[model samples]
Target chain A: MNHEKNIIELKNITVRFDGETVLDNLNLTIRDGEFVTLLGSSGCGKTTTLRIIAGFLEPDEGEVFFDSKNMNGVPAHKREVNTIFQRYALFPHYNVYDNVAYGLKVRHVPKDEIRERVMEMLRLVNLEGFAKRSVAKLSGGQQQRVAIARALVLKPKVLLLDEPLSALDAKLRKDMQVELRNIQQATGITFIFVTHDQEEALSMSDTVVVMNEGRVQQIGAPEDIYNEPQNAFVADFIGESNILDGIMKEDFTAQFSGHTFRCVDRGFAPGEAVDIVVRPEDVDIVKPEDGMLKGTVTSVTFLGVHYEIIVDIGGFKWMIQTTDYAGVGETVGLSIDPDAIHVMKKSKYSGLYGDYSTFSDEMEEMNQMSEELAEEYAEELAAERTEEAGDGAEEAGK
Target chain B: MKNRTFLRRIIGAPYVLWAAIFIVIPLLIVVYYSFTGPDGSFTLDNMKNLSDYGQIFKISILYSIAATVISLILAYPFAYVMSRKKEKTQQIMMVLVMLPMWMSLLILTYSWMNILERQGIINTLLGKLGHAPLNLIGTPAAVIFGMVYNYIPYMILPIYSVMSKIDPSVLEAAEDLGSGSFSKLYRVILPLSMPGVVSGITMVFVPSVSTFYISQKLGDGKILLVGDVIERQIQAQNNYNMGAALSLVLMVLIVLSLALMKLFAGESDENLYV
Candidate 1:
């Protein structure tokens, strides 16, 4: 958080495109050797933030700093930063080695040094023997690794990755997530990764910057972001949360579900409204007589490691994930320990998201979006190889 | 989907019949006529006459190659600029490119004739500038200009389409890797658009070499391209046998161009479409 330790700083960065504000006076500081993720859904200014840092998109009303230098007018090439584009964007005609060596060649490095660096980078990505292979012939994950290799071969001060794993399959996405985190740690270079995947943000990043609607909701450590979301959107976006309307009666006591419960969060005036969030994994089901609240099981789904069960209590649905299963229509008692109860000041979107609907809705939307992005990229790759000409605008029939 | 399959097969029947009747049969008849004499008897006379048109063939290739090179030099930047423009501007440029192609080739050449003549637009404009009118009409330059003008759109369309489809991120990727503007263009944009460049060359070269009207009007019989010789053989000379032989030579030229396209874009039918 100190200026001396920050590798990149965006000072009141604002970007507008065709009269629409994409980034509205956003400020963020990334520490040296830190892996920070800009976590947000679509149209949330995450990619725009990454581009401004890479010096590809200049902010309309603010200055960007790299190592305490003004980077407002610096072109992308002049900046000591590199970006792994969303779709890899590898040179289709170049082999893996040439693609990775392109930067060295541009910098006029010696042939021997270029070869050694390229080989080292390829080996780093575990593609040592694949230097001669055409990138067009590579699989999705292989191309992604090639992209990373190409960006990191320069040994830049900062590396910006824009949803680099969105094109891979589920299993490969998980594998690359771990591989990427390990690579970043090994290199010890500052990384600015942008993704809409909450699980990826939580698992991979040292610091997570939660964003929504072109504004920074909160920026903190991954655990801090998960445990203490600043508002309703952060609680909703980070993970599955059972958010309920509650009233703060007094210090450390909150009223919800037609009953009073103890909560650790305070500072709100007495008799004031608040939003309470309880993570699905934290809520435990207990015996009816010894439970905090009694509810009836509405639905149960087996999710391999855990069973996702929804319970209806006081006319509100609550999602609970546990190893134990609950049959539908069975009466179940739920207990939220004092620490599991989180209180947030209600914002404009208070009580807008239901517990049962938000989880599946978020999952479905993200899965669908991930698939669509992959499919479009696949089509673009096919188009690249086969060169689909526009219309039948030529006299040559063939 | 199942119901549409039957109807689709039915819809395709007409194209099958048309190819068999028009394309396949005509090609077979040309092959038969190439081997026969005026009396419809098998002879080697037409093959023997192939040497008579050798110089014309040489001239055709030279002029078309020169025209195709010039067109490439002129169209590359134009197409690149068009590709970088807004969607509305691209549409307008496309309309302008296709406008010249829609008119009959003969009319276009005649219009060029009007411009390149001794007392025509260029000369009249030069006379107004107090300079002597230069001779361009009935020269190789006039014929080459005609070919370049008519075939310019052929080169522009494929290149523009390919350039516009290039992911903007690829260019940014090149820039991010410390490439200058020239390096980005020479390394990335040019290599990725090679398929379009190949198709454009083939499209322009084949038609430019085989067009008789432009040479006849602009060359005015002073410069005899192979197409004009073939026309004279068939119409002015009444030598069908010799014309068919020369026509076969032109066919070889077209087939060779197609083969060159195949060599450069050996990837798929989608690339071959351009």
Candidate 2:
């Protein structure tokens, strides 16, 4: 219902540091008054993108447009955007009032107006009586509020926050997250937030831009992205998923785990290899004969809201999160509803992958295992070659 | 745990004893000498000879202040540009700045004597260019030059270490908040780098105020400062009481300056390096 024209547009922005690509020809468009989140793990160029928009950094190649105006060479001070940095880089020398009044002072606003506006901002962030206190005297959450108040006082067209809540404790961080969303809605400013926390991104953003290794993996609404991930990385990164290798026979039918199952997918070549992902919460533990596959529960970890159960189905590991507790060493059956199975095109680390990451410990273990398997295969080939040589000599003697 | 704590305190006994013997006992002796006469009778006459040493004391204090200020001006930009370079480049600069300190100060001053005195390097080169010889050395300028050259590395090290610890996020935030380069430097960088500056001043000024050999060598034994006054009173005149009194006065002045700097900067010295 709140569709608006694009307020900012990034056209193929690319950035490199130390001869290594940090952002590879990335493009994104943000609508007016939209709360967009760039979600990724560390070193995915989310901070770099935010800096480019704030004019603290210039992309090596591509143009940035602010409301259809070219903004390539503009410095940060000249631009109308402000940023809330990580760790809340408040000036230790200034009190809270002067810190909030800084942007207006830069523009040479009137003395009375600056005070009134700073007071108004302090009240908005609920730090009304903390005007005369020094920045270092405030607590972490208080300092974070002061930072937000300082950035919001200027009423920039777009505000960039670089993991602003990352330094707070978990309870305070949750409170601040909700407070930030409310503030953005009240002020009606475009908020581009960068965080490595997926839950924070999904809970707060109107659009989530999932990035991996200098490339944008997907961009969509949170619900759509969660329900219909485009590839293996999205499926794995966003939430708990059991990604299994499967073969598509035709429309509405797929074969996986040595069993044929119904799935709501089409337009695939018969007997085509594909990745089928099902959310852990979507799976149900049923009777051993009533389900499609049978497995024994290997471990169950209590996760507050639910229990996370790891099952071994014919030497393949699958993680399931369910409210119903299943005892370890019990034979269980996993039943996936046809609509819950999401078929994806295999691109990178798709089939039978859990916690997909390029440089994670799991990935490193997989690499070593593959190397060992290759060594065993080479030994077998050498043994066959020697046997063939012996057989030829015997045949010639005969 | 209590026994372990007692053991830890026992381990520090040697340092405590060493400090008491070498530092505390000597300071007490100086204090005692400043308040008594050669006959061991309580007297104030030795400290009351202020008029005799006041002129040289004034000149020493003024010239040291000048040298300290000049060294700060030179070392700040040097350390700033150096700290902003690549780590390898900074390491190279570290070697270059510290290389001069490894040589003995006497040797270093004697070498400068060859460069600044008449028929020295500059005047010889000028005469070869068909110019008349100029009075080259034996002045306050040459003494100050030697002091500044010798003590500059002290100023550079403290400032360099502090500047490197400044968080990059703070500068970026200043720019993002619409501060231009000059305002950013004025409002943020300079205030944050004050700890470095004050420590640099302390290092340079303390030595400059008490130096006599640099002046004696470069000034050709003509000019004298408070340090020369102390040397004459103690060694040549054999008056330890007056020398101890003058040292106490100099220590008070240095301590007062340090207190003023700390009051203004309003920050503690957390990182102290020699």
Q: Estimate each model's TM-score.
A: 0.85, 0.88
List iRMS for all predictions.
4.2, 5.2
- CA displacement after TM-score superposition, residue A391 of candidate 2 (Å): 43
Q: Give the alpha carbon lDDT tens digit for every residue of A1-398 in model 2.
A: 14478889999989999899999999999999999999998998898899999998999999999988999999998898989989888877678998899888877899999999999999999999999987878999999999999999998999999999999999999999999999999999999999999999999999999998888999999998999998888888898787888899998999988998899988889989999888888888888888889999888889999988888897777788888889999999999899988888888766535532232557778999999999999999999999999999999999
Residue pairs with backbone atoms closer than 3 Å in model 2 (clashes): none
| Candidate that scores best on TM-score | 2
Off by over 4 Å in 2: A1-3, A355-398, B1-20, B31-45, B267-274
lDDT, residue A92, candidate 1: 75
The TM-score of candidate 2 is 0.88
C-alpha RMSD values across all candidates: 11.2, 7.0
lDDT of 1 by residue, A123-173 (tens): 999999999987877899999999999999999989999999998999999
Q: Give the lowest summed-lDDT range of ten residues in model 1 chain B.
A: B265-274
lDDT of 2 by residue, B152-263 (tens): 9999998888888777777788888899988888877777778889889999999999998888898888889888888888999999998998888888888998899889
